[model samples]
Target: MEDLSIQHVHLELSENLEAHRTQGFSNANALVVRRGAPFRVSVQLKGRPFNPTTDYLRIRVSLGRLYVLMPVTFSRRAPSSRWSAHIDPTTSNKQTLFISICAPASSPVGSYRVQLSVFTQDRQRSAANGSFILLCNPWCSEDEVYIPFEDQREEYVQSDSGLLFKGTPMNLVSRPWSFDQYEPGVLEACLNLLQVSPQHKRNRTKDYRNRCDPVYISRVVSAMINCEDDRGVLKGNWSNDYKQGVSPSKWTGSGDILKQWAQSGFSPVKYGQCWVFAAVMCTVMRVLGVPCRVVSNFNSAHDTNDNLVIEEYYSETGQKMNLSKDSIWNFHVWVECWMSRRDLGSEMDGWQVLDPTPQERSGGVFCCGPAPVKAIRSRRIDLLYDVPFVYAEVNADVHTIILGQGQVVGFSKDTEKVGSLICTKAVGFPRLQNITGDYKFIKGPTSTISSMSSTMSEDSTTSRGSSKGVLVSLSLDKSPVAGEPIRFMVKVMNKQSVTKRLKVHVNAQAKEYNHSPSDTFWENHAVLQLAPMEVTVLRNQILPAQFEHVDEDILINLAAVLEDMSSHERFLASEEFNITSPELIVQVAEESIVPNKDHAATVSFTNPFPHPVSGVLTVTGAGLIHGKTQFRMSTLRPGGRIEQNVTFNPSMAGVKMLQASLSLSDRNIVIRGFTMVHINRV
Candidate 1:
């Protein structure tokens, strides 16, 4: 009888093992999975084929220190999205086999190495090896992402969310923005950010908070957020002297950011504020299969010290004092991640905060959180991460101080303004969920304001905070059309019993939303005289060119300050508006196509403005184009129409979404359009 000993054994891993080999898939640490999901490892053997009735296939799986040994059975059916081949030992000399394993709840998250051997007789043993990484199965009820949630499932699953960008206090939160978490480069970037060192690559499965750990991944993001490195996004210089000289309109999605970052050789991408940082971070998290959401905290305090109060000192003439070390952003954005709290205790498991913006430093680095939301809510300040800092952002009070003749004059506090709205994307809807009560003590209505009189003799010269005295209101006249004047009305009231003189300043600036407003495109200054309890209205208009950049989305930020010259009390308030670009229209010849057949698609648009545009058009879709296809075009004359045609063949059977984007590089104009094509299997 022929010996059952195997001549040679080789192993590889991928859903498409053949294609993976052809594409040079050589990542030693490439395998990634969640518990309960089937992980497939492919094995190929060539030898004197042993009869399966006499020989057996034995496999050993090693996850860091944990190990499992199991026997493999031959099957003709292929695994889902995977390749498996049957071995007819009597006729076939070469055989390929797929071993699919599902990790149970007790299995820890980490890299797994597998060894396969054919052993039937006691004298023969032949082996081959391969490996993969595993994570907590968030989709399973046994995991933290689904275990603790009673809310609808969509909020935790949606890739697109609503954010309030253009309104007073950001009350309007339903403008839809996509997260595009499944972009290929986003996952690559997240992995590259985490596995930076060789040690990280070597010892990834050792600890929950180790270098390859998700917590460590979040930390790497923070340290890299200064916009000074290859993957950095925001340039966070809070000093009065810095300016974002270039404006790149509103980003379409996080995929754009990751693509730009990767294309630039990992160099710093332009213009990211808190929301931009939060939004992109949300994309990275979700792309890596982590459940994440963007959260906005209005009147977010940058409490320099551990104390939960941001103090503001104003001059007698009612000008804001920038004298304090503490600062409060108008609104601050951060990300909340879902995971089991292995670092903290069980009760702390839920949403953990992870800030990617270059804020204050922690542990000698610029990262923050994975600080448990439960811990922040319960006032557990002594945790390992920045609990006190995050707590201050959501629950701190704004302590306002007024000074007259360089001395303490008045003291006031605003509780409602800080953390007024804590919002995330509404589950399964195009709306926002206000989760403010989740952060604050909501049993009784929290106090909005508290005031006290302090002696002017004491030295109150050093305090500075954020305030727009007594909730002043500003109104916009009408919606702004592109290439049209922007108009707004500012109304100030003299609430005292006597007549008073007021110094009112209206500053209107055009800024991109991804950066702070620094340039004043238009301004109006006036000294007005008002009677007791009288209202004064100032109407201001700015020309279209003032707010319009060459080819960028302009954000109109209006800051109006009404200062009481006699009483030295001031009211400062601000509002925001959006200027949008025209859309690119796409019309398809047909809605459906048969598999392996070609369909023609046409995209067209007119240049409404006087200037000509020059750029590349990037077309992308899954199962349509093999990858993204780009076409370059130069200046067509002013008012010229751009109509182009491209042919796409369906590779698989399914509904496919095809999108085209025209990026005017020099002029910075972006026009996007999409259409759906059905690929029917015949």
Candidate 2:
């Protein structure tokens, strides 16, 4: 087949031949060729001609996967001229190697370039170039070239054994000399065969003529055999010890043993020749009371020649065979078990494989290595599990698991501590719990005592001085209004003991309200202080006022904190009130007026209420000014009046009507009247 050149060529040679050649020839050249084609390639060699006796040349080709090295022996006479090599047509042509790349036939057709090198051993020099392409058959059907085996046949059969196979059992037979089956005493025999003469038992299948033990064959057959009769197989009751209570009579076979193990707490472990280990593990688990069975004839990469090749060895008979690496023929094996109600539907149920000896060294339990369980600690107690006895030394009053090493895999259902106390106070503060009681106070003679007494006498002899406890009272005339000042008075006297070093601090809350008119005038204020037993009156303190037009309610609030000067302890008091304008009552002072043409007319208004008056005034029915007239009056004194006037020129003839009215601040109130006047048109 001719190649359709399509691949790119990359140069990787060391020497530049095109520069040294002088015969109108260039060494820097490129070539493109398709795979599987006979082609000729030529290149000029630098240096003297006809030195072939000692010098040798060779070509190397690398098409990604295909590598070919060809030695070229040029005639000793023709060294200076262009050297050429023709690839042979045959598959075994030394100069032209055949490459049967086994890629999926469905692989996309494209061009792939490879590198070509020319080297001289004596000179230790080399030069290289390459090109490549692949043309796929457009008429080829994908199904015809890459048909899936599942769609072709329900199952496959071994031609030599006449046994039906579904998966990869036949593939194992292809390497007949490496693996085989055992007949009667399959379990014990396979075990003995594996242990005593592992090499001999392994080579039993080297020759097709050798008869495999029926017992070993039976074991293989057992993998395919399903347990219809639950006779000896343990169905459920995973907690039951099959070894003691349920004897071997309860198990169908070694497969049943594996199934039991799965029901308990076992899972599959995979490695090289995993099936062999799985089978052995199933038998071991069955003997250990776990119900299990094997799933046979499964294809797995673990059973391939890669593993077998590494495990290959010679027997005493001088025959070659793979050891346990080819343990389970081509067929894979797994165990399925019927879990008890406790484990049913749990992760422990279903099919599981046993741990196998590691094909390579590992660092964990169940393998040929150390246990990973290093240390353990209890949540409520410090219990060391790795050491001899399980004892707890330091018990955590709190329900917590603290481990020095390892992790908490499980926990017990119990509590140890009820409550915990955290210290939040500053470092200098004393840490104490549950405090209660009262303290006594004493003063030195240096402290001065002030005494004031009030006396009341009836008609009689002079009243004797009576010792009585002094009563002090504090009171305010009214709660402070926001934006307005507050007046306060305090009275103090000597009680059982002369009260000394007493000071009152009044701190008012400065607050603001939005949207609501209530408390709109409250402002935050600083703290105020008062002397002991001192009568003091304070007034006219202005508070800030924040007003929002949206809400019609007024808000007023005040807060004060009183502190004892001696103890530095303080007490707080607050007062709140509201400031609101009653629904506004507005009226116009003047109603109507009859003024001579061109004379100014005046209007007057009387506000009988205590509020500011504001509105727009208009004159209709007559030719008044073009724009409207507006008036504003400050919060009028009760029964106050305001006046205004408008002068107009009567230009039209006939009887003209003059209507004038006062706009009231209240939308519901309007004082209006009309007046008629005879006018001549100007």
Q: Which candidate is the best by lDDT?
A: 1
Per-residue lDDT over 195-294 for candidate 2, one digit per residue giving the tens place of the 0 to 100 score: 2222223453231111122112222222212211111122222222334433211111232233333343332211113333434434432221123333
Estimate candidate 1's alpha-carbon lDDT, on a 0 to 1 scale: 0.59
Could you give candidate 1's per-residue lDDT for residues 1-682 as a string of tens digits? Answer: 4555444443334453222111112233265565545555555555555556777877777755556776666664544322222443343433555555555543554456877778865647777776665554456665455444534333454333334332224333232344544444555665554444233455755533352245555555555544543346545533323245323334545666666666676666666656667777776665444577878775678888878888865544334556688766656778888777766778887788988777777786667887888888889999968888999988888776766577655555656556666777665544557677777776466433111111111112222242222223576665555545767676765555678787777776654433345456677788888787777777888776665572344355666665667656555555655554555676679855887888889888777655667888877664566556788977866678888898888765644566677887665556666665666878
How high is the CA lDDT of each candidate model? 0.59, 0.27
Return the TM-score for candidate 1, rounded to 2 decimals: 0.70
**Clash count list over all predictions:** 5, 49
The residue ranges of model 2 lying beyond 4 angstroms of the native Cα positions read: 1-496, 502-504, 510-535, 543-552, 580-682
What TM-score does each of the candidates earn?
0.70, 0.17
